[model samples]
Target chain A: DAGITQSPRHKVTETGTPVTLRCHQTENHRYMYWYRQDPGHGLRLIHYSYGVKDTDKGEVSDGYSVSRSKTEDFLLTLESATSSQTSVYFCAISAVSGSYEQYFGPGTRLTVT
Target chain B: DQQVKQNSPSLSVQEGRISILNCDYTNSMFDYFLWYKKYPAEGPTFLISISSIKDKNEDGRFTVFLNKSAKHLSLHIVPSQPGDSAVYFCAASAGDKVIFGPGTSLSVIP
Candidate 1:
């Protein structure tokens, strides 16, 4: 397994509350990504960071925000949670030159009530 | 518009049989493709991948074939086992950013 860990393996929160999920990697890879997995929808990219302070929005960036202040940690925040945001979130990392064989974390299951 | 699409929602195969999963993409510029497998309650794990420069790439019981002209790719798993049951996703990358398909649930019955 890659040295990637997603904190709070499971979380349950009420709607309209703020939520923050953390992803930590020990590999020092240059690319880190946050993705959400829903039934029948597979995994959709929410946001990603190429380096500290350098990030970009993915296809499903709405209602989500991310920050990478250091090489080892990338954080995703939902300002106001909604039932629609309930999904399994995963963090992935890849080397800058490899075939982009992303290594994924165990995932965080977030449920919004 | 979805750049990568896996039309099949689920597929079932008997143990020891061959399993084939299909994926399609509309982007011509995507030069790299990959497959990831995910078990229930777990994150996806890298399975196999092929570069657009080549037609096929194989690893052990897993093989990936890419058809550039047709803009499609497929994954073949021989002698499929019950342990192989999981959801598989197809992904395409232009650079460091990758787009993924909806995914296909594969069930291998013993």
Candidate 2:
């Protein structure tokens, strides 16, 4: 409902293959984040961008990379897919940096075989 | 180790009854807390939040209570409805970082 959309709502990829998920927002928020949700693990942040071209790793950034080329788009890439990486990925946008509510996209369900 | 924890994995409440969800945190630096609700196949939506300086904050049928000394927080939904069934996630923030709990699934039985 926050003008956010994620490409490839569902994806299936084999192990050791390259995969990328896209998050696009029209709200022009200053912060964007990528998270993975797994059973009993909740949501673990993979990476975040505070501003265009400025990004930082999160608690579970291992084996994942992200880039923000403009204010409207943020990308998450898996250099090489793994079975452990299969999970529901969500993208979020917030007007303020911290201590604020974030609007989330529908989410992308990625399966790695 | 998880900085945020939701000990309960599931809960059930009859329609028109009260639903309570609990959360605990280990980090003392957290200054803000929030709750989000998620339905199946959909991303989470913000429910309620409270500042560390406040003990309680209420919005309509939803209320959030924070106990800083205990590092605990809870969300209460009054007169629960079947439509309220979903997964609830509690989150804490410090500086520029925010951590989320494992989430508790609530089933409001009709």
Candidate 3:
């Protein structure tokens, strides 16, 4: 286990509502990423942060936003959730030296009605 | 366009047999490759990885082989057990940024 935790392990919300998922890491890794897992899509990177206040868009960055004010925490927000956004969200952290091996959190299952 | 691709959706193997998972990439700049395994309701865990500089790397029952010229890589698990059943994802990275494949579901039946 990599000292990574994702809050609200399971969440259910109505469509068009705001949703936020939190990821906390005790390892203080420099790179943190938020990904969504769907049945056929595997895990697609939604957004990532290399350092505090430094964020970048991934392949599927639309309808999603992320923020990292400190080294240990990264947050992903869906401004207006949609049925299509329902998926398992995972938070991962990676050290600079390791062979890019990411340590993942348990994951947050989000269902949008 | 997907840079990394895992064409197989699922594979089944008997216990004590060998399971081979394949991945292909279109990017030539990707110098590092890795494999991660995920069980149901759990996040992916790192399995094994190989660098572009080498053709093969092995760890215990798991091995990764990379063919830089062909732009293909494979993960081999020998004496597969039921515990090995999971979705395996292949990823490629040039630096710290990595791109993942769609993943293949592996079932090892006893």
Candidate 4:
């Protein structure tokens, strides 16, 4: 309920194809993060942005990329999807990095065939 | 190695009873811990949190206990209700970096 939204709530795409997921926030947060949730992995960060045009990789950023051109929008892209990339992706925003609670969007369930 | 861990995958508690969920972390640098609850088809929501310097933090029916010496923390809900049934995820933070543990599914039976 922190004014966050994710597009294409549920998506199913074939492996080796390109895919992009979008996260939009109205809170004007300085930090935004993208994460993937698997059965045993919990929530693994894919990437994060401190500000517009400032992006960094996360623990599980092997085959994923992210870009932020504006403060409200952060996009995660899979150049060539794989079966292993199929997971529930969540977008989060925070006023500060770790000092406060992060607000989360609904989530995007991606299934790669 | 996982810096944060939740050993239990599931828990069942009766309505009007207490529900306790546990979490452990291996990092000593972690200075803060938090708990989040999630219902099916939705993202996790912030529940409760505690600072490393404190042993306990309470808010309403929810209480979080931290044992720094043991590198353990737990969340307790009193008089649990069916609406409290959800997956709980624990997280640890060291400044700008935060790590998450695998969640524990809690079912509050009515």
Best by lDDT: 2
Error of 1 at A54 (Å): 0.7
Evaluated at residue A30, the lDDT of candidate 2 is 96
- lDDT score, residue B110, model 4? 97
lDDT of 3 by residue, B4-52 (tens): 9999999999999999999999999998999999999899999998989
Chain B alone vs. reference chain B, TM-score for every model: 0.98, 0.98, 0.98, 0.98
Interface root-mean-square deviation for each candidate? 1.9, 0.9, 1.9, 1.0
- What DockQ does each prediction reach against the true complex? 0.62, 0.81, 0.61, 0.75
* TM-score of model 2 vs. true structure: 0.99
Candidate 3 lDDT at B102 equals 92
Model 3 clash tally, residue pairs = 0
lDDT per residue as tens, model 4, B1-110: 99999999999999999999999999999999999998989998999989999999999999999999999999999989999999999999987657899999999999
Residue pairs whose backbone atoms clash in candidate 1: none
Query: Compared with the true structure, what per-residue lDDT tens digits does model 1 show for residues B1-45?
Result: 889999999999999999999999999989999999999888899
Determine the iRMS, in angstroms, of model 3.
1.9
Q: For this target, which candidate reaches the highest DockQ against the unseen true structure?
A: 2
- Give the docking tier of candidate 4: medium
Candidate 4 residue spans exceeding 4 A from truth:
none
- Return the lDDT, model 2, position B2: 96
